[model samples]
Target: MRTVRLPGLERPVGAIGFGCASLGSRISAAQGLDALADAHAAGVNWFDVAPAYGAGDAEAILGRFARGKRDGIYICTKVGLAPPQRNALLKQVYSMARPIVGTLTGLRRAFRRMPSTRNVSLPLTPQLITDSLHSSLQRLGTDHVDVFALHKPAHGDIGRDDIQRALQGLRQAGKVRLIGVAGDLEAAQIALANRDTYTMVQLADDPSAQPLQQLPPAGGPCYAVVTHSILGVGGTRERVLHALRMAGPAAMSEMIRLGYSPKPEQAVAELLLDRALAANANGVVLMSMFGARHRSENLRRVQGTPKPEALQWVSRLLAPVSESRE
Candidate 1:
């Protein structure tokens, strides 16, 4: 596995980290544990989880899998967005409905450039941050996380001294090794600006939505810029197919120098991972994988050479189409 050294970390971590959001929600506990073991065996040392993921089951499953192997791994979990306290029956119901809600949320964002029109008001106080991290550590069966992040926080939340102090307390107490802020572009900028407070930032990095473009040329003390959502899976395949039809195979081969795969989704995934690696040169790129095969494929693609000029050409070609609707 490829690795990058983040500031304050004792050692470098795998460039391609495992995100455990699908555990116990999309995949069975056994499958999740098996895949995790496979990843660890294959040299993937970074694991990202949150209380909000699988309604906290992902963390528990990861905890169970990580029990004996904690010494060799780097675990990252988020705070500020705790799952609702629901009964066992309700939790099961939510587990079933989570995918549907996610699909609808994606659709809404695709059309509106925003997630869920409904209001989700979470208090981002210092106490909340402190409390959330405590709960997250308990769920993950770890006394301290390598990195503790504020999940999808607002810009205002990142500027608060109380929140910063709370995170500092965690670090001082050895409950967290590094402080991180995870969210969209705005939140990232806020975190970057407050370098004294946060040492890491995690954000989505999709083809259509490149948050890297918004980052300052000289970032502050942030050592790790972790990125996720590399696979823009849903409508991306159709878009890529349409582009292939219009550009033809010859143009694509000449431009990208990479031959097209029979599976367009696999091709797209490769391109996305390449672009992500190129964009975040000094940071880790997190991808969610259910099985070993998928994880291996992703690791291979990320290790491959990327044609940034070719990707730039494609982006320029599609720029007009993107602007037309606006």
Candidate 2:
């Protein structure tokens, strides 16, 4: 695997980082650990996890797996957004409903329909940031994380002095090495503007969704530009499928005429990975792979050379579809 050095980090991390968003929720502990092991064996040293993922179970699983190799790995966990605290019964129902929704979504995809989803939001208050970081540390069994990020905060939240000070305190206390902002374009822009406070920024990147042109230039305090959603999650897949459906009987002919394959998922993955690599060539691209096959495939794609001609063709073919969704 190819590796790159971020400004604040001492060690070089793999170009493709592992994302643990689906851990303990969509996959079992054994599977998650095995995937992590596979990734490590493949030379992936960076891992990203959020407190809200798996309702606080992903961190514990990652912690258990990081026991022997904690020093070698670059772990990043978010602080702002966390699982629901109240509504125990409702939370349980939601938890149960997730897998059911995922299964149904898979079935729907088999029939060329999109699955609806919802996101749970949390306040990015100073107290919440401190409390969440402490809890994440406890769960990970680590004294400090390489990077601690604000998990999808609003643009206005980044302007708060208390939040910045809290993160500064954590760094001063040796609890976190770097502070980062992760989420949408607004949060990323806020981080770029306050480069003195935030050193890293994680945002979504894909071929059909938010392209690289939309992001701020990387430099100054914002040395690390970590990207995710390369697999076209969050409606990208649905959008692509919907576009193909709209093409009707001419979809296959159009793909062939454009010098691309007719397999939508493969095409999407290839295009997204190519775009992500090109966009963040000097940084890290985060991806989630639950099974061995997927882990290997993604590793190969990231490590392999980019196909510029194919990428250009695919980009041109998908431009109209991408623009229509905007």
Considering every candidate listed, which one attains the maximal TM-score? 1
lDDT of 2 at 56: 58
Clash tally for model 1:
0
- Per-residue lDDT of 1-326 in model 1, one digit per residue for the tens? 66788888988788889888767655668878888888888778999988777545788888898898888899999876754444354357545665564357464354233232122337888787788787777778889999999888877888888888988898999999998988887898888888887878899876666778888665445457899886654565457556655666665565355653555556655666777777776788888887566787876765554547535644543455656335
Model 1 worst lDDT run, 10 consecutive residues: 111-120
Candidates' RMSD to native: 4.5, 4.7
Error of 2 at 162 (Å): 1.3
Measured with C-alpha atoms, the lDDT of residue 193 in candidate 2 is 82
| TM-scores, all models, native as reference | 0.84, 0.82
Model 2, 1-326: lDDT tens per residue? 77788998888889999999867655667778988998899899999998877555789999998998999999999977655454354345445655564457565354223221223578777788888889999999999999999988888988689889988999999999999989887788888788777988899876665555666676444468899887676576566656655656576576557544467766556556766777678889998877676687778877764445545544545668666445
Per-residue lDDT value at 278 in model 2 = 70
